[model samples]
Target: MRMKDKVCVVTGGSSGIGEAIARLFAKEGGQVAVVDVDEANGQRVVDAIRSQGSEAILVRADVADEAEASQALLGVTQHFGKVDVLVNNAGVSAVGDVAACTPTDWDRVMRVNVRGVYLMSHFAVPIMRQQGSGTIINMSSTIAVIGLQARAAYAASKGAVLALTRAMAADHSHENIRVAAILPGTVYTPFVEGYLKRHYADDMEGAVETLKRRQLNQELMTPEDVAYAALYLASDEARFALGTALIIDGGVSAAKVF
Candidate 1:
């Protein structure tokens, strides 16, 4: 087992990529702390993990809130003794270019995607430093590196994530704490489904097909694909992989459409 006996905290673990990471961590023999605002879905994830005879607990809290984020970390530490890995996966997306985007939309997206990551890490880092070893994986996106239309705020937030990941890695590497980010292109998560419903309701199936063809590999990535990458970075095998942006975009970022 790659993560045998390890304790991991995954924010937004109720569903989507976060849920996939939590389940995969449990399957790999790690004790999981599933953190999210959705109490029902969070409990469902915990139940599913327990049904598989794995250890998991739900911590319902908004990751963007400093007090709640701190409490979530405290709960995990109290229950697990130490946090071996912290996955900052909770995030929200905003549509529209800068001119088209509302200030409210930008702030809301940044709150969850940027501030949430900061709060979770701010609380987790001290514990990791005291323990002398830890891994922090921030969920970034390829849109951070490439120009994606109608996602100005989202791109900005993820770009901040990538930058923050590097900063954390530089600050903590001396203490055996590794910080990294995973840049996944387009995965077919509920978030994407919701986006399609909102923006392409008239031709949902056609929109999905268009997205599939946009990928250089001609296939969409599964959440598990990103989960597997997180698993690797969180393991001892990736101890030397500090400050790395592990790209899992199925060659989308590498190709030039124009």
Candidate 2:
């Protein structure tokens, strides 16, 4: 029960890594707010958590929109009193080379991956500052530290995310607000699987193997693997960690294997 009585807000919690994080947090005793734009998927996640007797609420929000991000937090506060952990996990992707990417596509990624992080921290910080303690976890990718084909825009966006995490940490260190980013390598989330099936091959087996080959482990990490890392950051166990970009990419980023 590391998060006993704590209230956690996880954006994009309807599925994939975000949903996994939300479920684990609730199991560990955090009052969870599952925020996502998809009402059906969002409610499904909440219902599953409730079935386990956890206190979970679903809120719809497009975090790239400042008004919506703020309102989502307000909803969390209205129900749970205050948020102790904020996970900016909502993101969209674009597939284009560095110089060939459209400004519009790049801006869209920035709005969500970068701006959303700011919006959540901007509003949640005040609530945590008054309490003199809180945790912020921003989702990044191993691509932030390494280059990948068709990932120029994504890398840029997530790189900004890593920088934002560090900047937030420096700004709030004295205030007891811990900010960090998680860089997961090739994770087998619905997002990743779908991306592979679309781009790599029409066959599921080929798609999976193609993605796995890029990792040094020759395997893709599961959503639960990332959820465990996030759980550690959200709990009191990571009190001393700030402005750190934690990588869980199965040694892909640490080697030239990719």
Candidate 3:
């Protein structure tokens, strides 16, 4: 019951890490807002949460769009009365080195991964300030700190999120609006699966193995693993954890085996 009665908005909640966070938050007694552009999948998540006797609503909107981002926050607040937690988890990825990454690819990644966080926090922060308390969790990545080949655009976007998290925390921690970022290593989400299919189609298993090798544990991280980290940050227990970049990367960024 760590999140009991908390009103949490999880962007990208239709699937993968975002969906995992939404369900886990509900299970812990939080009222959940599942925000995503995929209306069908988002609704499915909401319905399933309700079936389990938990509170949830689906807000269909693309996080990258200003109008939609603003409306998504409005819809959540209207239904829940206040937003206790905002999880900026909606993001897109691009695969390429700087030269290989087209301007179009770079902009698309920035829109969802960086601007999305900015827009959501821009809207959520005022509401939290008004309420006198809230937690904001931005989804960064281990790639923000460590080097990863062919992830130039994604790395840039996540690094921006980490920087933004620190800046937001400096601006708001005193007001009781805690802002933090989670740096998770390659979680086996649908997004990652799609990446494997697209880039490593001939040897999907080998690709997954390669991903696992990057982590110290040699096992792929799951969405639930990262969701639990978000749960910790969103809960009152993490009140002292302002401006934290809670790394849940299975030692990927911490050590290397030679």
Q: List the residue pairs that clash in candidate 2.
A: none
Tens digit of lDDT per residue, candidate 3, span 49-123? 999999999998989899999999999888999999999999999999999999999999999999999999999
Candidate 1 per-residue lDDT over residues 1-258, each given as its tens digit: 999999999999999999999999999999999999999999999999999999999999999999999999999999989999999999999889999999999999999999999999999999999999899999999988999999999999999999999999999999999999999999999999999999899999899999889888778789999999999999999978999999999889887674
RMSD of 2: 1.4
Residue 73 lDDT in candidate 1: 96
Clashes of 1: 0
lDDT of candidates 1 onward, in order: 0.95, 0.90, 0.95
Q: lDDT tens string, model 2, 1-258?
A: 988999999999999999999999999999999988888999999999999999999999998888998999999999999889999998888888978788899888888888888888899999999988899999999888888888777899899899889989999989999999999988888787778767776588887877788778787889999999999999898988899789998888787752
If the candidates were sorted by their lDDT against the true structure, best first, what order would they fall in? Answer: 1, 3, 2
Worst 10 residues of 3 by lDDT: 249-258
TM-score of predicted structure 1 = 0.98
User: lDDT score of model 1?
Assistant: 0.95
Indicate the residue-level lDDT of 41 in model 3.
90
> What are the TM-scores, per candidate, against the unseen true structure?
0.98, 0.96, 0.98
Question: Who is ahead in lDDT, 2 or 3?
Answer: 3
lDDT of 2 at 217: 74
